[model samples]
Structures are given as structure tokens and as C-alpha cells.
Target: MARNISLNFRVVEGRDLPAKDVSGNSDPYCIVKVDHEVVARTATVWRNLNPFWGEEFTLHLPLDFHHLAFYVLDEDTIGHDDIIGKISLSKETIAAASPRGIDSWLNLSHVDPDEEVQGEIHLDVKLWTEAQGPRLRCHIIEARDLAPRDLSGTSDPFARIFWGSQSLDTVTIKKTRFPHWDEVLELHGEEGPLRVEVWDWDMVGKNDFLGMVEFPPDVLLQCPPSGWFRLLPFASAEEDAGGKLGALRLKVRLAEERILPSVYYQPLIDLLVESVLSPAQDDTVTPLAMLDEVSSGESRQDIATQLVKIFLGRGLAVPLLDYLNLREVSRTNEETKADRSGLAVVGRTHLRQDLDLGVLGYKSSSHVTQGFSKLAWCEQSVGAGPGQVRTSIPVCRICAVERVDENAFQQPHMMQVITKNRDGQLDTMYIQCKNVNELNQWLSAIRKASVCNEGMLPSCHPGAFRGNRWTCCLQQDRTVQGCSRTHSAVTLGDWSDPLDPDTEAQMVYQQLLLGRDKLRKKYIEFSEEKIKLEQEVMKGQSCLEEERSGVPEQERPPTATAAAHLLAVLEDLEQAHKTFEQQEKEQVARGSLHS
Candidate 1:
């Protein structure tokens, strides 16, 4: 029995807004929806405060989607798509229900959060960083120690383990975010006694997973998943942070779930065959004595061949091409034409090694004329003319016997084509060929011609997954014309930093508009209040002067430049009030983004 490797994705959003960093308490962690049901939500542990408790919800996803939107009042906020700040997706596949481990799958780059850094200044203070190092490093600088972060993510170098876990035989590095990092766990034995190694953690070939672990017999028996982990190995004092106070307790969580994300799989057996058989070979024969055996969960063809291989004879045989290597060209059960050019099939696919194609195709050399066990064909021939050459006959599969009713869909007996210009004398000549590549290339050119030269709804052809990035085109009747391709702009990964000149400019422009609007409202309210206050002050001055001078009291100075100076002072106060109002509004908006 083979081990099954797997992945499961977990997402955490800052729901309560107290929702702290992913490693700590208060994280709004939620389990992925399985079969359209929200069975469980992840546990939130705080980094600053180490309180662990279950985060309950009266409102769930979709059900409380509106509530979530309300909290997300500012879409322009920072960390909108964070590992914890937002809800992304996960992709994981477990072949066996019994909990067996998997050997390997594709797309395993285990560094998303590792590619970036996360930080905050304060609820009211100022601090900024553009965490950009390699995949697995972090950067931290003591506050008030430098200028704000510049364009680059380089500054104080730092290190962080996104996730960590402890296991039986060996610990592992893991993540639960989907469409996120891809990681692997490998186990190789030592000295045939007790040497076990599980490497390939990052898929960067860093051997992030490569290590020697001495474990019990059962521990190294199988491979592990990405979620497995352990604490950092005890380092000597020299390697420590060397803190005067001591190491701070930074909250952490070892993810227990995994996600499949967007996985592209072909057939496993196909890969195995590719590894074993040489493309240069003609006969389906394998030599064992020349084969070096390694335990990579690899298998071969015949018992005789296996015996030869194990016994040091030239007999390493695996018939990968005979089975999984074969491809069905059309719905008619027509096998692909043998490529004398011998091009290797590219892309991801899967192969069921347990099934035999000889049984499925019902192919037999003895009945080559009547292939497919109970199948027959029809034929027709044509005559020759001045510019034409004739063939004896055309052959087609007419009927098939066994499982013909079982598998109903079949390709047409033959593909049809119509040629507009047979002379091939045009500058732009379109020719149809039996080759899939040629056909695809021809379609590609036509598409380019259509999008570039002529304007069409949605631009390129309706069903193409990708367009001619180099050129676009159009066609009228049979002739075609084209132009260069164009693309839309793409922004940077993070929008939090004000270092972006455009972003800064936009902010300033918006702030100015907001300030102007607010001051307009305040100006009216302040004017009436100021006038009334001045009247009272003037009356007091009048009474005081009248009582003192015996000459008309108004004639006394009433203080120098009385009304004008008073009004000017009042205006200054009003301006100050407006400034405070604008700052408060901006602060409220900014707090929501990071808080």
C-alpha cells in the first residue's frame, strides 16, 4: 500500500477588529466550507495577549455576509487581503480515507507570507515597513531608529517562521491558507537501519525539509503532511537574541489544516514511466544490471524483469508507454498516430496504474484488420485529375462490438475540411493539417489577426483561454490583417505604504477636498456665534467707559482696534477648530485600516 500526501486550507479574518495577528488570540479564524456547510471556525490566539478561547459567532459567512461588509466600511483600508485580515481559499486532496500519507503532488512553493513582512506603528503613533526580503526572512527595526520605509522592502533584516509544529518522528513547517504556500514532507531511510530524512519543505530545493531524524520503526514508515512541525532546536547562547530582559513570548500557532489550492495533476504512472524508460529506446526492453535502484516509491514491469534488476542483471523493465503513455485521440476510440519524432507529452495528468489498457482498448495484433475486438470500417476511393492525385480508398471505423453500447460517445468516422484557395499562391495562406500543434498554431494566428486589425466585442475569440499577447488581428472573408497587442496596468502587491508617490498625491488631493468641505460648514456656524459674543464684549466695554469717563463712554479707546482685532482673533479660533476636525476624521479613517 502507498502512503497518501494531503493538504487542507484554513482562513482567518480580523472579524471583531480586535482581531489581532494570526499567531495570537483574537484572530477571526474559520474552517473552510465542506459540502456548503460551515462546520468549524479556527481558534484565534493573540500575540500580545496569550489568551486562548473559542471564537463564537451569531453570524456566519454568507449568513452574516452583510455584517462583514459593514465592518469592512472602508474598502480603501490596508491589509484587505492579508493571511489573517481576509478570507481567501484553500486546495487539498486526500486519496485514501484511512489517513495514509501522500508521496508527492505538484505546485509546492511554500512561501506567501514568507515573501512579505507585517507590522504596525500604533493606534495613534507612526511606524512603517515594506517587508521585502527573500521568501523566508523577516525585517524588524527598533522604533525612532531610522527614516520611514522607502520603496524597497529592505531595511532591518528579520526572520519569521509562518507556522511551526511538532511530530512523532520529525517536526514539520506548515500553513493552512489556501491558494497560498505549497510545502512538502519527505522521508528517506539511513544505513537500512534507522536513518530517516524528510526534505523538500519549500520546493525551492533548499532542502528546507532535508534533515536526519532518528525515530522508532513506525515513525519513518510513511511520509508526513505539511501541517506537521516542531519548535526551533535549542540554540546556544551565542546564537540567541541576547536580550537583557529575556526572550519575549511571541504568540504562535501550528496550523493543523491544509488547502489544495489550484493544483494541476496529470497521471502519476506516466511520470514513473518517463523516469524509467529512455526516450532513445526503440524496443520495449529494459536492462536491470544497468539500473540503479533507489526507494522513491518506484515500480517496474515484469516479475522476470524485477528479478533481473534485483539480481544485478540488465532487466529494469517498465512498460509505461504500453499503458498510461497511450492517448485516445478522438471520441471514436481512435488511438493517436505514432510519432516517429518522439516528442514527450508536456503538462500535468493522472494515470490509473491498476487498470490495463490492453483490456480496455481490446487491441490485438492478430485482429489488426478487425481491431477493437468487434469493430469494422468503411472505405471510399477517388479519381485523379490534372492538378489532383488520387488514392486507392479511404478507410473508416464502421462498428465496434464490446462495450460499444457502454461507451456511447465516439468521434466522427472522419474529420472534414473545405479549402478556399487550393493554389496556395496568396501572401497569407491558411493550410489545415492533421497535427494538433499545427491546428492550434493556425487558430492562434487567426485569433491574433482578428483582435489586432478589427475591433470585436470582448476582443479575442470567444473561447480562447489566452490571447496573442504579441499581436491581435481581424479578417474579412479569407484574407486577414493584424495589429500589436495591448495590456492593462498592474499595481504593486501592497498599498499600505504612503511611499508610493501616486498614492501620496491622491491622498493629499482627497484630504484637501475633505478639509475644504468641513471648513465651509464650520465657517457659517462660527460666524453667528462670534458676532453675538462680540456684541456682549462691546456692551461691557461701553458700560465700563461710561461709568469712568463722565464724557460719553464710547469715546474711550474700548481698547485699541477693538472690533477688528477681536474679529481677527475669533477667525483664528475658528480655523483651529476646523483643523482639529479634519485631523479627527482622517485619524478615524486611518485607524480603521490597520486596527
Candidate 2:
């Protein structure tokens, strides 16, 4: 089976980096490599002890990968970019973690002790959007005690910023132990996070990490504060406050619009369904594979479950199952062949047993046979041995078949087969089997024969098999010929009919209805929030109008200030109302969609 491999790499910000340049702060950027192949590179944040790089990448790889490595390097104008430090994760280590993928502060490991790579990189990663539509703004102000990689002790440094796949770089500052970029990067997207990194400028090799940092949408939106944040070591290490390692001063904020409607999910699901219908030649490109890549944390499973529901909604569950089953079959070719061979051997063994006529059913007089039994059924319709009688019942006439239980004076395995005659009259006969398993096989064969012949058998009433004659059949008019057949001397057993797909599908559909309740709750909450926001907006507008009208009698400047405040409040209320309305509309659409 092709295992789905989801890899998410978020290069947030690094801080408290060791100085690599002889001049000053080392210019630093991150290099991400899968196995031995380089996949991504972060722009350098220069001349600062603490740098922030808010970059993220999601990759869909096969299970064949070996290792994932992250390298931090310092850029020098004259020499090759020097590797500050590197950290790596083996495939086994990653696979052992959660299927949702790991998100934590992994300490950067170094290859050489002489090269000190000190700092912690912070990242914020999760699945889906944090808001409907959000704008992220990051301010890069200054850095202290940056790793210096230059020969002159003072190093030229620059800063780089990343969000999603896009990247931006700051102009280089020459010969500065402390460089202030005071740069701001603005981005708009379905809410996520921003990555920022600082690196010392190198005309020759590579820019190295001074520091790095990351701001997730939620954090930025909730804590819109500007201050100096302490830069920690790149790799896990002991702490030092105001010594060699320093801090970074910057600001970040996130602005988001109202939530989008759930109706928007239809297109996404349609795309996924389309993928299943026509799977990609490359497993990595399949919709499910992409889904695994884009989603992270708890939302990944929710998204997958919702997609399944969507597939069911479109009446494609069976096809999807077949597609998945095909994949499974392809993966187990050798096992399937072995199973086929095993089945053939078992089939031949059973075939020999079936030809042996070890038992027979016959009618007896006074519950006891004379010397010869009447109305006998045998494997050979004609006399197979001396004094053996032919069976009048034909296998083609058999209709319904069932397994019967064993009781006192009866064998443990027994079955009953019902057959119809040319005149529409039906006869039921009981037969014994070697065991329960053989009984089930006999019952199946009889039922199949009935279907092949398209014969309709008479319904057997509860009292139909009383003693030697069918009591229910005898209850009819005297003109009717009641069936004169002996009931099997065995107790009836219990067996369920074969499964019906339509009925089973309905049962599954009922189980999925639970998700609807959650959606309805969300809808109600969104509607209430929308109403509250609208009311607030109205009240703010009314207050503004009242203040304007009273401006003539009050201090003009104070009235203006009060009016401005009301306007601002109304604006905020309007924005909030818009967001809630969007959410409510989506909820309603989703509720109606399945219905």
C-alpha cells in the first residue's frame, strides 16, 4: 500500500544567535533538505542578534524518504557561506509520532562543537484558516549581539521575511555589530502565520542566522503589542539574559474579515471527489494526499471526516470504496495469489466429499419405515445401490433454504429446502449434514438453485410442519390437496438472510447525521452574535446623531471628539456584524446542503 506522507515545515523566527562573523553578527538563513535534496531556503535576516523568519512549506512525499535536515548558515562576502549549525530528523522518528504530524520546539543539533549554534526558532503551525480573510503586518526594528562572520569583526547584515511560499529581503547594512532594519512586511491570505529571519550579509558564501521569529494569526490578532522580546539560543541551551546573546524589538498585528460561509466548502469537496473519480498518476498529487499536506493538528482528521461525508452526500461512497480497495489489492499481489492457491486446494477437497452419498432422507410409516423407505432423496436420483430408491424432487425446483436447529433425538446439523411443483404446490424436505459448516454450504446451494430456476416457493406458516402432515396447508378448503410430508425430526435453528446494500447504506447515513447537530449549534450562535453586533451598530449611530444635534449647545471640540468616538465604535460594530453574517450564511447553506 502506498503510504500517505504529510510533511509541514514552518521556519518561524530565531533568536539569541551566536556571533559567527569576526566583524559582528552572523548573517543567517535556514536551509531545509529532505533526504539529501534541498527543498527550501529562507531569506537572511542580517546584522541582528535576534531575527524573525515566518516562513512555512508543506510537502507531500512518498514513504521512501530517509531524513529531513535543517541547516543554518552565515553569509560572508569573501568566503563560502559557513554552516552555523544543523538539526536532522530520521524517517522512523517522524513516523513514530502522530499521524497528524508533529509540531513542537525541536532543539537544533550541531555537528561540531567548535561552531556554536545557539538560539531557538519559534513556529506556529496548524490546519486550515484561523480567520476568513486576514492581513498580517510585521515590523522589524532592531537586534542586539548578532553573530559576526566577517573577517574585520564588524559584519554586513540584512533581514529576510517569509509567509507561505512568498519571500522578501532587507537591504544590507555594512560593518555594524547592531543593525536596525525598521522594515515592515504586509501580507494577505487565508489566515496563517508569518516567518522572519535575520542573517549577516556575505558577498562570497551564504548569509548565516542572526536570529528568527514567527507570529501566527491568532497570536498577532490577540496580542497586538510592540516590545523587545528576548532572543533565545538557536538550539536548546542554557539561558543568559543581557550577556552575549541579546533580544529583538518589533511589532506584529493581524486584521481579519468575517468568517466565510460553509457553502464554499462544496467546491473544495467537488475537487476532492473529482480526484477520487480520476485518481492522479502520482499518489502525491491526489486530492487526499494534498489534503494530508495542507491540514495539520486536530483539524486534519475533521477535514478528512468531512470529506468522507461529502463523498457520501454525492452518492460516490461505493465508487470511493472500490478505488481504495483497488489500491489495497495492488499492494497485496503475492498474498492474493497465495490465497487463490489455498482456495483451489480447499475447493478440490470439498468437491470429493460432496460426491459421496453418505446420508439420505426418506418417509416412514407410523414414524417407522417398513423394510424399504418411501419418498427417498439421494445424490443419485435413480437407485445408486441395492434397494436404494430414486428421489422424486428435482434440485431445479428448490426455492427457499434454511438451517434448522438440532434437539433431542436429532443430529446437530440439519437443513430444510423448499421446492415448488408444476401446479404451484410446494413441498418442504429436511436433510442432515456432517456439521454446521456443511449445513450452511448446503443451504446456500439450495437457495442459489432456486434463484437460477426463478421458481417461487410457497410460504411456510408457523404450524405448517406439525408431525407428518402440514397442518397449515390442511386448514384450507377440502377441495385443495393438502401437502402430505413428514417434518424433519430435528429442531429448527436460527439464521439471518443475506445483507441488502440499500438497507445498509441507509443505516450508515443515519449514523452520520450526528454532525448536523453540531452545525446547527454553530449556526445559532453565529446568528445571535450577528444580531448583537447589528444592535450595537444601531445604538452607536443613534448616539452619534444625538451628539451632533447637541453640538450647538456644548463645547464644539468635545462634541466633535464624542462624535468621532461613536463613529469608530459603529465602524467596529459593523465589521463584527459583517463577519457574523458571513458565518451564519455559511451555516445555513451547509445545513440545507445535506437536507
lDDT of each: 0.23, 0.46
Compare the candidates by lDDT and give the number of the best one: 2
Which numbered prediction scores highest in TM-score against the true structure?
2
lDDT of 2 by residue, 366-429 (tens): 1211111223356311112344334555655665565432321134455566677788777766
Number of backbone collisions per candidate: 63, 76
Clashes of 1: 63
**Across residues 1-595, which tens digit of lDDT does each residue of candidate 1 receive?**
0111112222212222333434433323233222222223434333423222333222111111110100111111255322322221222322232233222211111222221222111001111223431111111111111111222211221112221231222232231000011222222222122322333234333433222223232332333211222212122221221221111111111111111111111121122234345432322211111111111112222121222212111122233323224321211332324321121121101112212232122223332222121211122211112343221111121110000000011111111111122343222111223332223222322222122222222211101111232111112223222111121111111111111222222222222233433332233233334354346547775322222223332442322112222223234434544565677679899999975
Cα displacement (Å) at residue 110, model 1:
21
Error of 1 at 517 (Å): 76
Poorly placed runs, candidate 2 (over 4 Å): 99-101, 112-595
lDDT, candidate 1, at 231: 17
RMSD of 2: 35.5
